[model samples]
Target: MKLQKLIILFFFILIGFAGISQNIMEPKDLIPANDEIVNWQLIDSVNTYTDEDLYMYINGGADLYLEYGFNKLGSCKYRNRLASKIILEVYQMKNDAGAFGVFTINSSGKGKKIEIGNEAVQYDYYLHFWKQNYYVRCASTVKSEGVIDTLQQLAKQVASKIELPGKKPELFVLFNKTGYPFKQVKYFKGQVALANIFNFSHGSVAGFNEGISGKLDDKMVFVFSYENEKQRREWFASLKGKMNMSMLFDQYTTVEDGFTVKDRMGIMLSFKPVGKYILAIKGMDWPEAQPVFEKTSTNLP
Candidate 1:
């Protein structure tokens, strides 16, 4: 019985070691053979995990990361001779757009933008940046001399090890800019992302590879690309039938192929398909919205 127990314990130990090995990541090697400080030490280890294992690190609000095609994550932290610590978390997403999604969601405030990777927004104590499929978050709590510069240096070192597609989504650049504000443009994929912000249709079967939305004056405008023209036509056909029929029982008048459907509270919405994409201009009367949507359509590819 004692021998059997020892064997079982060894087996479990090997399994535990395997699990530990899986979390180990290698961002890069920036350590020197010796430090300037007489008794300097380093506390550094690379840890990697998947989106499913994300909850282990972050308690809540992880669904958004998963929705954006989070694939893997690598974390690196270490201390310098001066006892200053730097921490960085690198997220490898599915594609460039996915990385951009993470960057877009986390990027706030009027932080200084840098040319680090594709784009990087820097803040006082931390920074969030992305290039290709990697979104990196680096923060330094140390208020030591040159700590900020050291953090940036470490960010660049890690960023160099990563690869970049050097490309943005094709549909991402198709949004009309004639009337749309440059600062308000948003590019996204997946239906949930749309419903959360665009609210175009709930659980619409349409699968969009990518889409863009922006403000056209006081009204909101959106452009979505389908897999192909066939898919686009199918969704449009189904949408047209419901829209045309919905206006029948309400205060709606057909204009510009689409109709002015008024809600019970009397809010009007206008939507029209331009080329392979759809155009929607909401929060304005049909008579005034018709010309704007038409003008907006001219800018669509």
Candidate 2:
């Protein structure tokens, strides 16, 4: 009888560990349980998607997620007694950097920054954040009573369920030095996002690996990173060649290891290539942007 009881206890311990593992491994488990949030109930089963079929769900936006190294997605809907509906989406990216990249692009820069997860932003009808390798969004569809509050509540619950913490990319340090607000920064790896930032119109020159764009004191700063010095030089040469030949740019001038040009909009821009990164500042002359250029260049990884 003693031996049988011991065996039974061991079996239950194994089961307990398996359950914990399941909760950690499944992204869908990030959804708030019906009892987790007050008065809001999950309306249906969580929907899961992978890289192979994510397009069926998000359509045109799938490419953007894929560009950020998408892994899988889990989403669900919730309803409250007042008939308000909230949709929750948890995107599991390949890594923390990928998750942070997606969050930066998806967020509206004007949203109220919050502290629910590793980073969070709250809009009137939605709340989103990135934690660990998961990017979570909670959006309310109806403007019923307390709907916005519930949306944020639900987002917080989801964020708390995420067990690990996430770190921003290494390139973010350069932008940090410029005093750019964290919520206003954008990070990306490919042309899809690059086009949305400031269009150089030349699509992915030099095959750059990662980039950061942000605003500081009415000036726009851009940093593009390459795998090596060779690619950085190639990009610099291509951009310089374009500035010289393009009718859209004027007042092309060359400075020490860099150049300056004014676009058709008359916005003066400066560009400097240092180490494995290329730095550009819009709305600032080379002389003015040089200080910022050197500050960021000195911090390059």
Candidate 3:
């Protein structure tokens, strides 16, 4: 009876140890160091490589935030002695957040690795022909099992297609009639569009005024049109529930014969207070007014 009890206790202890080992990620599972083509050097931190180091190596860049406990990891280089065919990355897991992890291969021939922890997640990988004269990195949480693989594959694809541009894009600002700044806008000539930030005001509004005839998503816009007194009153009434109180206009005025029309000449000005800003929209259309309404609704002080 004593011998049987001892045996049962030993069996339970062995099972518990197995369970613990399975839960704990192993070094081999993190990064496979045995591959001949791929070489990995575990470094202490990310700052180990300097600008000079990056300049010296043709295929060298740093992979940071690997492993759950590790705050950061250092630079890595892939030497294509034969020819540069593929880009690879090797990383390690750091902390419980699973935000930091290494990139490596597995026995199933999968070409990526992830470090998942309780709080954070990280992606470490290499690119084939990266531009921008700096190492590219994307940091986010490890929310799923295949996230690492997805990121690694994306990095590979981006690196392969990267071409260094000759010059960078320029920035431009747009203003409304009242001269209040708008926070969100988009500018486009044809199919190519660029996002921008703009603000609105009471009488005058400014935004990306050009290439705004069509629809947009989550954008702020301003429009100017001609309307008669009655038409303008109806338009203002239509905006009652849609207008944000905090951004409503303080006052408005109407002008008779203000502009030339075939049969009639009249104009109206509707002013609304937009916190520190204000806005005036003439001949508001549903599509065009939507952005303005949204911006005012979520107005930022």
**The candidate that achieves the highest TM-score relative to the unseen native structure:** 2
* Regions more than 4 Å wrong, model 3: 1-73, 85-301
Q: How far does residue 256 in candidate 2 sit from its true spot (Å)?
A: 3.2
Clashes per candidate (backbone, < 3 Å): 0, 0, 51
Clashes of 3: 51
> lDDT by residue for model 1 over 111-219, one digit each (tens)?
8987687888888888877876777887776666566676576667666655543456665554534645545556666666666554443444255666766655556
Best by lDDT: 2
Which stretches in model 1 have alpha-carbon errors above 4 Å? 1-44, 77-87, 140-151, 163-165, 176-181, 200-206, 216-219, 236-255, 259-269, 282-301
Residue pairs in candidate 1 whose N, alpha carbon or C atoms collide under 3 angstroms: none
* Alpha-carbon lDDT, every model: 0.65, 0.83, 0.30
Candidate 3's TM-score reads 0.22
Q: For candidate 3, lDDT tens digit of each residue in 65-141? A: 21112222233332223322222332222222222111111111122333222111233332211122212333222
Every model's Cα RMSD, please?
Answer: 11.7, 7.2, 19.5
Rank by lDDT, descending? 2, 1, 3
- TM-score for each of the candidates: 0.66, 0.85, 0.22
